[model samples]
Structures are given as structure tokens and as C-alpha cells.
Target: MDVEYFDYDNYTADIDSNLTTEGTLNLYSASSSSTYALVAVNIIICVLGLAGNSLVIWICGWKMKTTVITIWYISLAISNFLFCALLPFEVVYMITSHWPFGEGLCKLASSALFLNMHSSVFLLVLISTDRCIMVLFPVWSHNHRKVGKAFGAVILMWVLSAFLTVPSLMYRKTTVHGSVIQCHTDYGVRHKAVVLTRFICGFLIPILMIVFCCSVLAIKLRSLTHKSTKPYKIMAALILSFFACWVPYHTFVLLEIDFKKHNLEVIKTGLKVGATLAAANSFLSPVLYVFIGNDFKKTLRRSLSSRIEDALAEDIRTALR
Candidate 1:
């Protein structure tokens, strides 16, 4: 038995099919449109995410004193910045499917993408865990959860994420196929294992940890004497936003394994849509988690200009002195 297939070199599974000319043309057209849309959305997300996360890093790192919460936010912002900065390369690659950036750069880009993604998720897990601990055992958390510990946790997460992304560096390549050099991972015999590992460790396990922590936080908040539950509500919103944005991505990631048995156009469209949603998560995080409070927004607005002016005055005073 012979099978004919169309190859989508980046992130899609092998398609085994014998299709009519019209069907193939439709698939190609659909894929092209989806790729264009995905790239466009990624560009938008890149701009907004970079700006948003940059502000977050500045605010949390410079304007405020270091704390456990600020450390977590800064870590998240740094990862998001790296992810957003790398998005332009993806846009270029998607537009031309021709890898002009050499194989080493291709591997680096792929590895960084996964590294940032996993790091972001793990940071979210850390934040959730910290909040849960604070709610459940305020005295213990107050005494034990220091900024230094948060920094250590962030460093550990980055090391773990790098280790997880080693597969990307090993498997990724820019292969010339029919005059088009495509950048993609060629996992070979490890394809299924890689996919399963990513789904389990990257998505499922972290999300489970987040959910458990959030649940405990919620229960503790409900049992408290204070009727105000604003903190819990904010945390819930953050978790819900993350799940909404990433569930599609992880779902399509698993489904791509069986994409040969599915409709090509549907699978491709779903994958693009999922990627856009997941990318948008980086842009949304700063607003949802850090800037949602009215007091925070007002303080930022009021302080930015005054802070700049004050710094300039201080510089002049030092010069005069």
C-alpha cells in the first residue's frame, strides 16, 4: 500500500492521504490563510506583550521594594518579554517557510520558545502555590517565603525549563525540502514521547498544581472573617484566563498526533487558533494579574511623571552640589 501526503513541517503531524487535486488545493489555501492570520496575531501579541511585560518589570522591579510577589511577577515578565521578542522570527518564518536564519538560529529560536513557555507556566504555578500557602498558613508564609526564596525558585524553574527544552535544540532543524527550507522539529522515533512528555509536564501537571493551590486558597478565603474576597476573585480570574488561553493550545498539540485521521483544514486551523490564543496569554497576563487593581493603575499613572521629574531634579541637584 502506498500513501501520499502533504507535509506541514512545523508542529503538525504526518498526513497520510490520497486526495483529489481540488482537495489538495483547498488544504493549501486554508493552511496559507491560517498561517498568515497566525503570524499577524503573533505580531500584535508581540508588540502588546513586550510593552505590557516591560512595564510590569519596571514597576515591580524598580518602583517597588522587592517582595515574594514582586519577584514572581518580575520572573513572569522576563519570560514573557523573551517570548514576545522571539515572535517576530516566527512571523517571518511562517510568511516565507524559507529559513534564511541558518540551522543554529532555528534551533535556538525553537528552544527559547519552549523554554519561555514552560518557565511562564512554572512561574504561574509558583505564584499560585505561594498565594495558597499565604492564605492557609499566613504566619508560616510570612516567616518563610522571602524574596530570596522566590528568586531561588525562579532560578530553579528556569533551569528545569532549559532541561526540558533540550529536546527542541536536539530535534529542531532547517531542512531543505523541494527548494523550501523549513524550520521544524524532526523528533524521529521520539515524536510521540516528546509530545506526551510536553502534554504531561508542560500542561497537565502544572495546571493541576495551580488548580489545587487555587482551590485551597478559595476555601481558606471563604472561611475567613472578612467578607471581602477581592484577592481570591482576582486569583480566580487569573487562573481562568490562563486556562482559557492555553487549553486550546495543549488540546490541539495532542490532537496533532492523530491529525492524519482528521480533516487537514480543520486541524491546521485549530492549531493556528490555539497558538494565537496561547501567545495572547503573554500579553494578557500583565493586565490581568498586575494591573487589574484600580489603586495600582492610579498609582502608576500618578507616579510615573512625578518619578521622572523627581529623578531629573535629583540629577541636577547632584550636579550643582
Candidate 2:
């Protein structure tokens, strides 16, 4: 996710010139209304994501039984929650065009965003693949799947995500661009390589794996004696929401790699909008659970916490039988 920095065209020039006081004031004065609008949207997403994901963490982590499914949901919610928690720093930078936090935090905040991306996608892949395996080999799954193993998988995913986020940590820094302290990634000559790696490793491969798992699950579920579509619906909702939220952001990120060839204004607008959409994904899973879990109408009559519990309580094994 590209930090919504100042207009890159003048940004570079201003920095190169070692912005004079007049230039700094002019840059501050030139702030656009659309930037504020995007900040507003980000604030809204931050609040909702914190609330929704906190609820999921509470219910799944504390109220529900520790099953493999609950473990997956908890890990996902934790990632989203941590990312949302850092939004205030980003929001401050977006509004003031300055990073008040020091360089250490600048790096951490930037890396955390990618950490959430990698961890979330990896968890989704794990969920889909786990479900596929359960459907294909119920006996083996029943015999072997344990909460400890689920915890182990979650740990491995987070470690791998942290490993992938090293680029962000290495490249993200706070540079005094005139009066403004800007926190941005400086990939130097390797910008394209880093962006492409993120797209392929972070987005492309995981999405393909998810699609394949979902396809296999769909086909296998069709031949089962009991034809309940609830699990399929839940998985489909998760996959679709992931695709919808991420595709735009990745599209803009790729476009940005060759931004010199494209309209800078259009690319900037797309990036701001794309980033807002991506941030909104943090809360989407909890909303999906509430609306798509069990019988919606019946769940609505219960307490919200109970409804969420019911959602997490869904067992894929039951559907197989």
C-alpha cells in the first residue's frame, strides 16, 4: 500500500531544492480537498475495523471453543486488528504531510501494513486449503487435526509474513523533505523488483491457490449426500471479499511501477481510493460472518455476540456427514 504522500511530481523537486520557507508554505497551502476526504474514509475504516475485529477476537478467542476453524479466524482478526491500530499514525501523516513519529515507528508502521497483507492472505489460503483437505480426507483430518497443530500453522504463517515484510522495513524511512518529515519507501533502482515481488508472492500466488482450493471444495461438496451450501457460501464470501478489496490496490501499485508512462493525477487518485478500499477489508470478515453465518434471520434474533459465536461454531465435518 502506497502511503498517500504529497504530489510526487513536485515532491521530488521540492526535496531536491531543499524546500525554502516559501515553498514549504506553498506546499502546505496546496493541500487538496480530496486528500481530506480520503483521510475521513480512512478514519471511518479504522474505527469500524477496530470494533469489528476486536469483537471477533473476543468471541473467537475467549467465548468459542478452540477448534481449528476458530484458530484461523482468531489469527486473521488479530492481524487486521494490529493493522487498524496503526492507522492513526498514517492518518496523521496524511493530514499534516509530516510524520511526527520517529524513523523507528515509520519503518514499523509501513512494515506492519505489509505484514497484515501477507498474514491475512496466508491465513485465507490456509483456511481454504484446510477445508479442501478436510473435505477430501475426512478420516485423516479427524484423526490428525488438532488445536496445537492449528496454533503451529498460525505461528508459521506470521513468521513467514514477517520475513516477507523485510523489504518494507529496509526501504521505509523518515526523510526531512524541507519542513515536512516524510515517511516513504526508497527502493532506489529496485522499486520495480520489490513491487513485482510483492504482487507475485503476496497477491498472485496466494490468490491462485485459494481459487484452486475453492474449486476443489466446490466440486467435492456437490457429490456429497447432504447438500448444505452454507460452508460454500461462507468460503465464497471470504474469497470474493478478499479479491474485491485487494485487486484495486494491487492494480494501482502495478500501475505506479510505470507511473512515468501514465497520467500521474489519475494514478494518484486511484491509489488513494484503492488504499481506502484495502483498509476497509479489515472489518469485512466479521460483517460476512454475521450476515452469512447460519440462518441469517434466526441469528438476527439472538444477541450479536451469540450470532458471531454461531458463525464460528460451524463445523465443516458436520457438513460432510
Candidate 3:
């Protein structure tokens, strides 16, 4: 997209030399009123997402066995939980229609929000690929896909994610303008570092991983017979749902980039809707993921009836004793 710049003197002082406010600068003409409404919706999504994901954490944490899927869910729940923790700040930012969190919080909130926000997509990609390996090559999965190894992979993901997001940590700050402050990334040139980071960690890598893994799984299921089709159907549904849910989001990112290039109004609507759909990803997974692969489904089903009964029975016996 060709770039356009507007003079942002109202929001611009000596301090805000590089900063630009949308309305003050007439930056692409996004309505503040509409942005506030989406902010409200985002808050609701965050709350529901937090509650459901927290339940996933509780169910998986104390009860489930250490397996590849469980490890991934733990990674997921932690990220979502932290993501929710940062919601009120953004909610306040939106409700007031300004950035009230201040300069330090601008960096802190942006880092916390995005570190976990974007990391989740990559982690999920890792999970899908991990499961595909399990299905396509059981022996290899058994040999290599242990909980300890999964932990290592998660740690690496965080390190890489942090590295990718260094620009946000370094340049993110609050832009104060005529009694209003807003949190934003303060990249001057939108350099290769920022652009590539946005593309790779945010969009390209995770989507490719998901698409490839799901494609492989689809092929594997096609190669199976009628007797094996039932479980594969459910697995296929779960996998397909993941892809379906993410499409709106990924498409939105592409559309946003396109719109930013052309400054198209129509694509902006899709982009907004797509981002909302993406935010809902945190909530959707807890339900879909409760049954995706071998270990999680088996362990969840196994624990469903017996583990609780046994625990209660043990408690009763203890009381009698």
C-alpha cells in the first residue's frame, strides 16, 4: 500500500514528534464511535474467554496426566489467562476513548497483551503439527513427543516470541494529545524488523503450520477405511473447526494490510469482524481442544466418571476412619 501522512499538531508536541492520532491527524478516517463499540465487544469476549479458559486450566491442571496435548493446553490456558488480565486496561482505554494507562503501562500493557496474544497462534500451530505427527507416524510420536520435550518447545516459543516482539517492548509508549492519551506502537519507518515481526510471528508462520498439518491429517483420514472413519470424523471436525475459526482472523490480517495499502472502507469492516473472530479463538479452543487428539480426549473421558468418584469415595472412607 502507498503510504499517506497527515499533520497531527493537536496530538503532536515536542514529545510526540513521531506519534500520530487517527482523528487528530485525520489518519484514514476511522470513526472513534465505532472503535468504542468494538472495544465493548472485545471486553465481553475477553471476559467469556477468561472464564472458559480458566475452567480448562482447572480441569486439565490437577486432574489430567502429563501428555503432549495436556502440555499444549497448559501453555494455551496460561497465555489466555494473562491475555484476560490485560483486558481491563484495554477496556478502560476503549470505554473512555483514550489511553489512560500512562506511558509505562503503554509498554507493559502492549507487551503483555501481544506477547501472549500472538504467542497463542504459534503454540496452537505447534499442537496441530504435533498431533499430525502422532497420527501419521505413531512410533515416532511415541518416541519423541513426551511432556518434557513439549515443555522445552513451549519455552522456545516464548523466547522466540519475545525476540519477535522486542520492537513493541522498546518503542511502545503513550501519546498524550489535548487531554487524551492512547497506547500505540511507535515505529518510525515501519522497518523490516517491525513488518517482518508482524508478518512472521503474527500471521505467516502459524497459518502455514496449521494449513499444512490439517492438510496432512485430512489425507491420512482419506486413506483410512469405514471402520476407522468415526473417530477420524470427530478429529477431522475438530481440526477443520480450528481452521475455519482462524480463517476469518487470518483473512482479516491480509485484508487489513490490503486496506492499509489502498485505504478501502469496505475491507475495514471485514478486518474488524475478522479481528473479533480471532479474539474468540481463545474461547473456541477450550471447547474444541477438549477432544482433538488421542491423549486429551482419552484422559478427559477417563477422568469424567471415575476419578471424581474415586476421590469422593476416598474422602468418605477417610471420614469414616
Candidate 4:
């Protein structure tokens, strides 16, 4: 919506007295009211994701026998966990509806954003390819698909992802909209250009390749109809889960541009809701690990549940004192 929505004319009815020509125009718009909800949700997510991801790292790195595939997924999960740790700032931004964090963070946040943008798809693609190789050439996989090779592949994937997302870092900025300062990337009309580029380069292209690779693997691996093939099902779920989470987010981003031109009440409400649902995606990734862990996590979690509950109870009791 550019900065017009916060201008004297549109907002004069609600906040005429707050206006200041010389002072910073506080950009707190109606949208900034998601503060309390954002704060609570963010804290919960960060705590859970940090604890869960730490558990995953401990399990994969120390407890389990080292496999190349385990090493790859562990890295991906750790990255996701770290990125979610930064959710507190986003929560703060949503709650206070102010960018009090400053311009440097605003730019830095864009770089952090690149991690999420590339990590999910690339990891999924890697998993699919890894499976395909395992299925199609079972004997060849043992000799070749070593931990070192998986590590090399992950490095290459990240380099390509980082190269594509460098543009986002370049475009992001903290802009004053009113009493609420917000961080976003603005390429003006060139936004559409970036969207198309991302669709082709970031999303559409990778997704198609993943599907194709999986289909080939599934067909070739029909002979080895054993329990080991279940990982592909989990991988399939991950790919679709990624799509389910992100499509709405990207759709809302486009809808926001439209919302600027016409602030219809219905559209605004839809955008607001969509924005919340999109935020939920950030928290959903760690949950996906449970679905993949068929027997191991369930048994371990059940055994530990009581002791963990006792510890939690003790912490609450101490806090109350």
C-alpha cells in the first residue's frame, strides 16, 4: 500500500493529533494490534522448537549410529531451529507494531529470511534424490552415498540457494508507515518481476524436479517393497507440507499489494487471517519430525514424559515462590 494508508488524509479521522512534521511518524497501523497473540505464540514456538531441535541434534549426532542421510537431515533441522529462534523479534514487531530494533536488524532479518526460503525446498530435494539413488542402484548407493558425499551435496545446494536469495537481502528495508514501523522489501513495480523470478527459480522449478525425481524413484524401487521405503512417504509428506505452508504465505503477499489499492473490510480481514496462518507455518516444521519418527520418538517420549512433567512442575513451583 505504499505509505498512503498512514498519511494525514486517510488516518486523520482516527489520529489527527499524533501528527508531527519534524518528529518520526509513528507507523502503528490497525494491523499492529496482533501484539499479545504474536508474543505468546512466538515464545511458545521458540521454546518448543529450541528444545525439540536440541533433542534431535542430540539423538542424531550422539545417540544414533551415523548415516549419511541422518547427517543431512540433522543439518537441515538445526538450521530450521535456529531460524525459528529469531521468531522473538518478529513477535515483537507484530506485538508492538514498531521497528524499535533499528535498520541494521531489519536488513539482517532479510538475510535470516534467506535461510528459510532456501533450506526447506533444498533439503526436501536432497532427500528425494538421496532416496532415488538408494532405490535405483541399491548396491551402488552403499559405496557412494557416504556421509561425506551428502555433506558435499548440502553445501552445493546452499550455495545455489544463497545466490538466488541475495536479491531479497538487497531489497529489504525498514520503512515508516505511521506510528508503527515495519520491515519489508520494496522493489516498487519490480516486485511482480521478482515474484515471477522466484516462482520459476525458487518454487515451481524445484517442486517439479522433486516430483519427477520421486516418481522415478518410486517406479524403480517397486522391487524393494519393504519397510525402508516408508521414508519416501515421509519425504512426500514433507514436500506437500512445505507447499501447504508456503502457498498461502506467498498468496497473501500478493493479496497485500491488492489490499493497498482497495482497503475493503472483507479483504483486510482475509489478509489478516492469512497472515496469521502463514506465521503458524514457521512453528510447524519441528512437529513434522514426529510424524517421521514412527517407533523411536514415541517410545522415548513416553518413557521421558513423566520425568519431564515432574521437572516442569518443579520449575513452575519455583517460579510461583
Clashing pairs in 2: none
Model 2 clash number: 0
Best by TM-score: 2
Worst 10 residues of 4 by lDDT: 1-10
lDDT of 4 by residue, 85-115 (tens): 7666766665565677888776565455456
Off by over 4 Å in 2: 1-30, 293-301, 315-321
Task: List candidate 1 stretches off by more than 4 Å.
Answer: 1-7, 10-31, 177-179, 289-321
Residue-wise lDDT of candidate 1 within 105-185, one digit each (tens)? 787765665676688889889878877776677688767877778778989999999988888888776666577665666
Report the C-alpha lDDT of model 3 over 172-241, residue by residue, as the tens digit.
6666678966565545545334545665667667778777887887788688674143333333454455
How many steric overlaps are in each model, in order?
0, 0, 2, 9
Q: Which candidate achieves the best lDDT against the true structure?
A: 2
TM per model? 0.81, 0.89, 0.71, 0.74
RMSD of each: 7.6, 3.7, 8.3, 9.2
User: Residue 288 lDDT in model 1?
Assistant: 64
Q: How big is the positional error of residue 164 in model 1, measured in Å on the Cα after superposition?
A: 1.2
Per-residue lDDT of 176 in model 3: 67
Full ranking by TM-score: 2, 1, 4, 3
- List per-prediction Cα lDDT, in the order shown: 0.66, 0.76, 0.57, 0.58
